[model samples]
Target chain A: EAGVAQSPRYKIIEKRQSVAFWCNPISGHATLYWYQQILGQGPKLLIQFQNNGVVDDSQLPKDRFSAERLKGVDSTLKIQPAKLEDSAVYLCASSLGSPLYGYTFGSGTRLTVV
Target chain B: GQQVMQIPQYQHVQEGEDFTTYCNSSTTLSNIQWYKQRPGGHPVFLIQLVKSGEVKKQKRLTFQFGEAKKNSSLHITATQTTDVGTYFCAGLKTGANNLFFGTGTRLTVIP
Candidate 1:
């Protein structure tokens, strides 16, 4: 089986500029998650989707960050007016919807805000 | 808000040495999962422990969940250069679907 796929392995944007990262989870996976990992830190959950419907977004910066998993297959995370603090690796993961089953993560998109 | 924390943010060891990382949560967890993220790569799931006092082993790695479900540990026997990476433990709260990840422990193995 193929692993989760992400595009634009790297991105650089100026402060206040906008950027978007795309992800395609494994086939047949109904639960998708977006995480942000800063250098030397663990990945933080940004948002979660269960088959196109949001299951959680409590940690997402609503004023700047937004994500959507359309058709319950692929997901896109957008950062509007990117800030220096937003420079981090964005990871996407998918699971079988049961905690018993672990998640499969993508290679991630490394974003740099200047 | 829930948080998980890991001790010894970084560790260095020679090949064939033993290494261990610990994870703790403020509150009890329903389940805990461990992951390894190689340098320049994404996190890969290593194992999951759900029951209290549960211990699982894979190859030279052993994972343990506390009886109180608020602490966990990962022990590696005879570490190898390939074991160099960041180890993270994520805990899920009761009735919650989201996971809270701990500050990872970065391991460097010198061969």
Candidate 2:
């Protein structure tokens, strides 16, 4: 089976600019997650989707960060008016509904906010 | 709010020495998953523990889940240079559907 796929391996944008990263989870996965990892920190969950419905977004900064998993297959995370502190690696991962099956993560998009 | 923390933010060991990293969660966890992220790479799943006081091993590495299910540990014996990377523990809170990730422990094995 193919691993989760992410696009635009790297991105650079100025502060207050908008940027988006795309992700295609592993085929047949019913749960998708978006995580943001700072240079020296652990990956923080931004949003999660169970099929087409959202399961979690409590940590997402709604004002600046938004994510959607349409059709329950692919997802896109957008940061509007990106802040300097928002510069980090955006990772996407997917797994079966049960926690028994571990997640498969993508390469991730390294975003740099100047 | 849920939080998972790992101790020894960073550690350096000789190629043939032993190393260990610990993960603790604020709430009881139903299951725990471990991942390793090499420099310049994304995290890759290493193993998962679902039972209380469970102990699993792969090659020279050992994983243990506390009896309380709120803590876990990963031990590497005779560490090799190839074991260099950050280890993370993600815990699934009881009755919850999402995972709470740990701070991660970065290990450097000197050859």
Candidate 3:
């Protein structure tokens, strides 16, 4: 089976600049998630989507971060006015159902804010 | 707002030695899953434990879910260079669809 696919393997932008990341989950998976992982730390959930509807976004920084999984297939995460602290790896994961089935992550988009 | 914590943020072991990392949750978990993230790579699911006091083994790796359902552990026997990576435990709370991940533990195996 093909693994989750992510685009723009790496990105670099100055603080206050905006950036976006794209992700394509495994085929037939209905649940999608976006996480931020800082160096030496675990991935933190930023948002979760069950199909096209959002299941959770409690951890997302709504003011600066926003994500959408249109058509319940591909997802995109956008960060506006990026801060230096936002310089981390943005990971996208998917599961057949809930996370109980475990998750498969993509290569992730490494963002560097200068 | 549940949180999962991992002990021994980092561990260094000699090849052929044993290694273990612990994960604890602030509340009872309905299930727990483990993942391995290689250096410069994303996390890959390893296993899942549902029932309390459950134990599962894969090759030289052993996974245990605590009797209280709030803690878990991963044990590696005869650690190898290929075992080098960060191990994470994610716990899903009852009636919740989201999985809360632990801080993770990085392992370094010296040849």
Candidate 1 per-residue C-alpha lDDT over A1-114 given as tens digits, one digit per residue, 9 for 90 to 100: 999999899999999999999999999989999999999899999999999999999889999999988798999999998999999999999998855588899999999999
In candidate 1, what are the lDDT values of residues B1-111, reduced to their tens digit? 688999989999999999999999999999999999999999899999999999999999999999999999999999999999999999999988988899999999999
| Candidate 1 chain B: 10-residue stretch with minimal lDDT | B1-10
| Candidate 3, residue A10: lDDT | 99
Worst 10 residues of 2 chain B by lDDT: B92-101
Of 2 and 3, which scores higher on DockQ? 3
Ten-residue region with minimum lDDT total, candidate 1 chain A: A94-103
Clash pairs of candidate 3?
none
Interface RMSD of each: 1.0, 1.0, 0.6
Question: Mind giving the per-residue lDDT tens digits that candidate 3 earns over A2-43?
Answer: 999998999999999999999999999999999999998899
What is the C-alpha lDDT profile of model 2 across A1-114, one tens digit per residue?
Answer: 899999999999999999999999989999999999999788988998999899989889999988888788999999998999999999999998855698889999999999
lDDT of 1 at B32: 98
Candidate structures ordered by DockQ, highest first: 3, 1, 2
Docking level of model 3:
high
> CA lDDT of each candidate?
0.94, 0.93, 0.96
Candidate 2 vs. true structure, TM-score = 0.98
